[model samples]
Target chain A: MTTLAMTGRPLLQVEGLTHRYGSRIGCRDVTFDLWPGEVLGIVGESGSGKTTLLKCLSAQMEPHAGHVVYDTREDGPQDVFALSEPRRRLLMRTDWGIVHQHPVEGLRMKVSAGANVGERLMAVGARHYGEIRGAALDWLGRVEIARDRIDDMPRTFSGGMLQRLQIARNLVSRPRLVFMDEPTGSLDVSVQARLLDLLRGLVADLGLSVIVVTHDLAVARLLAHRLMVMRAGAVVEEGLTDQVLDDPQHPYTQLLVASILHP
Target chain B: MTASPSLSLAGIGKQFTLHVQGGVVLPVLAGVALDVAPGECVALHGPSGSGKSSLLRLVYGNYRAQAGSIAIRHRGQTIDVAAASAQTILKLRRYTLGYVSQFLRVIPRVPAIDVVAEPARAVGMTAAEAERRAERLLSRLRIPERLWSLPPATFSGGEQQRINLARGFVVDYPVLLLDEPTAALDADNRRTVVSLIHEAKARGTALLGIFHDAEVRDQVADRLFAMRPPSMAA
Candidate 1:
């Protein structure tokens, strides 16, 4: 009933989801339902499996057990893994965009900043070079990066600016689901605040649903509608952002909240 | 100021000369001047294309600036960045600085640890010494020990940045110039970067880099300047 509240149907559904990397365990038994236009914050420690869980959900990584079912407007609750690899890739390349923790690592460092943004367009069959270039510039300006720097290498941009460039690169495709891992961590507090404002605006305007991975509950409070607390690769607590952050039942969650002090 | 600068720039200005049908010079930075004292961490804050990176390159000796001068203190001796002896700037970069540009600047197919250790080998350190230094630095930065041998290209975004940090700091250089050390990270990795800056500071290496993150600037920078746009700055 709660998942049905949104008109678009549940965008992504997970149940009994788990993953492991060889002998090391990543996320175990993750279950949730994501709503459209919702911001879901995944928070945990350095070793916690937040990213693994995110990767599984996005089909970037495969889970060892359980199922990640995606509810698309065109289709309904399709098992992401059950689909053919080609189909899964097709679904992801067109609908979902991922922003890695480090923009430079996620991006082609040797290419011009504009090329990095235009890449997604190229992937989705936008072959016209001039059109892609224009779209790239518009997206760059939208993220508030200087248009002139579009020709420069990403190394030329400051850390926060590089993150914004990545955001522009991902958002230019206008994907329905954007996965941002610590989107503002590299940004200054002032710049972070601005970036948060920008992300909030774009998420609303684009009607994008996002799964954000971060370690700060304060950041979750700022941007998330729902918060999931993870420890050692498992979800210990989950609820509305404010509730989980303000009245945490899990000890690990409480410590996380305590550390979330005004920053 | 100390008589010797681990890295120094005076009246430095750089321009990108674009030949569009005809020769026309486009200036990116002008009249930029600063010095990094031993163990000082200086944060450069400017909008993109405000020449923050060009300044880093000039200090790294990637390119020779037509105007002004640059001098870097390597070990006990001063290495003139504007050296008259060479037809190349790459040689100077190899011997003097360990630069971690914003992106993955290492050669492809290089392992994360090797990418960091390569510069040490170029600096005349033994292979064993370089490997040991790289491992120590990566371990200190929270890179999972399992990932050390793997190529950084295979790493996650956060993993690669940790390796980048390790490489930049592995061998003790009198100066370390990073374009943006922690620009793309999640919260935990950001904390890791903040701590690495501390480790570098403790070793008495002069740091000069631009940071857009306020948290990073507040955590390490001894001095912060708000650089005006070049036209407005002049």
Candidate 2:
């Protein structure tokens, strides 16, 4: 398949990224560049090593080998693995947001919705209480939550609401790049549509770059500009979302597309 | 005489009065007429500010129309959406009108599976039966079994969306409104939605939708209604 045109400057670059669990290769020799304001979708089945690549890219786990570089707001381009722990933490707090598959995993279930969102702002050094609360309220609304529920704990919120609240928390600080692990995976169809619209709007409005790992091709089709198809710990195909999804060159990709329920 | 379409909008117009600048009137949609036949999927195509979403809201009686009649055939009765009372609208919405919006509004602390089964439970199905259906749909949509029992408070966006889809589709209404139904879905899930749409159509539901993604639009839409911004309208 023809490759997508790499536009602007690369926001995150992964070169020969390989991770393993003893003898099992999680992902091997995975290389890609995510550009500013672009969304890259990594598509593969469970146990296909997509998650491993995402973890490596997000700096949540150390890869066995390979280099992951991120263009920092302060430093021009720095290898993320090379950054000091405090600096990486700072970068994660400021320039990056990670949305896990489970909202509870990413969110503080014990805290009120307002606090969950406000805490991100606090981490970024926003000390004024009123401003923090105001920003939290604003983000809650943006994610389609009732402002009145801001004081409620996440444990009280429903799965969909919790997910929205989680998104609100991650996005309150307007980070430049977001790593989403199946961001829209578990919700109902109608709710999924709304959240997708909200997320698309936010990505556009803020010019945020995103790396979303999903097993669903439709999710990748809607939100991703570029596509990376992985299997057996290696990239099988990588191209523009349309090029790869529509006219897949790889046999595995064809099988994946063919496997979709045509009902 | 031929029966009226399942949904008919004639010369529909809507405008928002700006609060500032001495009530500057902004005409968002005007003189729009469309018909959706039973079992048909009609796509509302437009630019961002073109009022496609507003038109759907108007049909659903969420917005008041200024100029025309928005009518739907429900239980063998023709209800004028423009002139319907709140109670009438509510009654129609309960069983006749189904809307799959972009976002899901869920109750707190509810398990994701239970949330999907709510609509089924509401319509007199036993909790076990409702949950059984919910489980099948959730599994089809690729929601993991482990996450089923847990409250969605922590589920990712896609997982939450699958639950929402299961909920919206559980009722099997005769007329359905979809606003970007597959927007957040991965390819596999999009195909699932396509199949669901086909199933709804086979059951003779009239569908009106907004599809920004051309590929999905091509996959499901039987026809297209081009909506233009007021400034771009001839």
Candidate 3:
């Protein structure tokens, strides 16, 4: 059976999505459907408006035009931008998650790692401190953090550990759709590899629908099933990850792939 | 042996337009047609750059063909790979079609067993059962027990290829595409791959493969489809 037939409807659909910074175009005329459990990568070099598109999609910034329709658990397909502020806030805290490029931006530096994760559960109306703490501990273990480090402040954690903590914090609420802004961008190569592996496994196991923005093609290839290549605030190409990377029908894409320094 | 074809490609055409090089169009395959019936193995015979791998990729929905249709019989319905949505193609890849490329590409740091078992898990096999099948295939393919928990990145070329093979065979897909599956294998491993191909064909899987090794091709392939570079043929 087809995935469309199985899932019934797309988890998220972006129709002619356009965003702008004053007069400068951020991203233009972008449209795609994200199926359940699909990982769609947005790849471009610096200043390609990948982050801007992500912000608009995540409801952090309202787009100049177009619609972001999300299939809510309770409601059917609803325009994300048209929702009330409190409803949008609830959606972000409940069914949606946004992971920033920097862990510090996504985490509460003052709180302990366990509390950072537990806070999400709390926002989702989770009661009982013991239960929240228990879930936090379980999530910490899943992210490869040591049990002893549950009470440690996120500021004290290593860069990789902090990213993992941020991921755990975002994922504890069981969000169906996650918007990640270069989740592994700030880490070293080996650390990035480890975190990418963790994200890949978690995405598969949880069947999360993710839109990851990255400049690194290797990261996109590893985590994304499909890719959209952005250039000058517009999509130059979009296709299956291997198709876009290997055959690269677009000249910009070919240049990007050819520019990678092969070890 | 005359059962209907599980995979069919008709009037297929693919060409690469090199925009950077002054918009030059490189013709790869033109007006090609192919079919693989149930319980059959079709080998793609060609020299390098003859678009054998490209044909397989087109069938797998990795590379979109410029023209024509790739009709696959999946779950009692015919789905055109050329026109299918990304989600449909993904579902087809998961439940209907399986492809093993020449190289092993996987997320770094995932254990080799998990990499091999992922397809089976995607197709609804329990983690335990999928891991069991993965272990069996790895053992039969002669992967060391110690290496099962380690990533295949550091393994020898042949070992990595064997791991790829184990992954392809992990799930019993109705249609399979293999790209130089045994190219880097040793005699023993090659023998294992040949036997695996035979077993898959016996189970009625329609296979389209590029077996550069003549011996392996002769052993597993029921027929050969010769391909020449369209531009070079003229």
Candidate 4:
């Protein structure tokens, strides 16, 4: 059953995404199709440009060439790279959220939890602090943090709780799509498992689509519907999560799988 | 069951007075005690108000205990964390202890590589030697070489955490105190990190951390400390 890749109209299509850094290889002619409601895992070792691809999709980094087309499930396809600043702001201001492997990247450490969540609302035009704080507390509770800690600095949190705060801060805005980069790269194994369970549970409950960048096959197995393996800045293999994992075709993918020495 | 140097607290306690509204004082942590040993990975499990993190902070020397003692036996010498001199504590932290907080606790604007290498460079390594070592450590942690030259703040959460780990291990501190390192990952990234922790422990770094996940507690923790409610703290 895992081998049956879901077939549907692509929600996000990348065509010839070629990026470079002064003669260095950085994802050459990368192409892929992300369907609606899909959890696509982009897996690769360090320097594989998995993160770069994520940044490009979110319009945080401009691609040297090629185009990213995000087809809003409710609206039509929009070329992300070609978007004007104002349009990009509108999109980011309304429809997108991003989570990083580290908790602080998505969080405003100095601000209260409410402000972190409310910053998104304010960016899209929420004016009142009361409303922002209210929403922030709600999001905090959603992520299972107490309402009282809403005013506490993020530094006071544990790595797991900080990550949860990052999630709350991002997901509070109700964006249709979210970007997850190395989502749990700093946690212990058991904490990783629980956080994974929380994230999968949240994703299912929110009915949100996510693009997760990671280097672990085991992670992709647990949370992703499909997996794309990248090698030297290119998609070396891709298919249903199980297919790519169970019977990897690319030599690099094979080695990557073999490297999974679980105890 | 092996006897590596242990981190222990006997009647370890802390308190602070805060003046609310009209010069009032509040005690944050009171009569807290815990222990960890060389080769021991201990997990502190408690809710937000349970003083779990306060105990970690006390161990890291960020919080000075209003009462009781914080000490660790290292290199055949036991140093009191509360009474250690600034220079002494700085030296101890650099060579013997690694503390990873939830936030980027180090000062900003330092290059990621420099952030990791500063401790090694502090004792005596040349800049070039430190640079080389830093690169190797960050790369092994899977931090992209491209981001190594940038400030840690410029990197993503995961990237920054890798830098923190690199910094912690660059000096090869035998004892590491980590606060909830994997709360943000989706699944795959989380497992990779956990795997790395296991690898580090196998390499002989004793770890004391606060974790929210029972799975994390079971996987890496040799012992678990479940804090009682505030009323039972003393």
Task: Give the poorly placed runs of model 3, Cα more than 4 Å off.
Answer: A1-6
List model 2 lDDT by residue over A126-146, tens digit each: 999999999998999998899
- Among residues 3 or more apart in sequence or in different chains, the pairs in candidate 3 whose N, CA or C atoms overlap within 3 Å are none
Candidate scoring better on TM-score of 3 and 4 = 3
Per-residue alpha-carbon lDDT of model 1 for B99-140, expressed as tens digits? Answer: 777777433344678778877876778989999988878877
Q: Best DockQ goes to which candidate?
A: 3
Q: What DockQ values do the models have?
A: 0.01, 0.02, 0.52, 0.01
* Worst 10-residue lDDT window, candidate 4 chain B: B16-25
lDDT of each: 0.76, 0.84, 0.92, 0.75
C-alpha displacement of B6 in model 2, angstroms? 45
Q: Which wins on DockQ, candidate 1 or candidate 2?
A: 2
Candidate that would win on lDDT: 3
- Candidate 1 chain A least-lDDT 10 residues: A1-10
TM values, all candidates: 0.51, 0.54, 0.96, 0.51
Interface RMSD of 2: 24.5
The candidate, 1 or 3, that scores higher on DockQ is 3
Q: Per-residue alpha-carbon lDDT of model 1 for A70-102, expressed as tens digits?
A: 775477779989998888887787788888878
TM-score of chain B of each: 0.86, 0.92, 0.98, 0.87
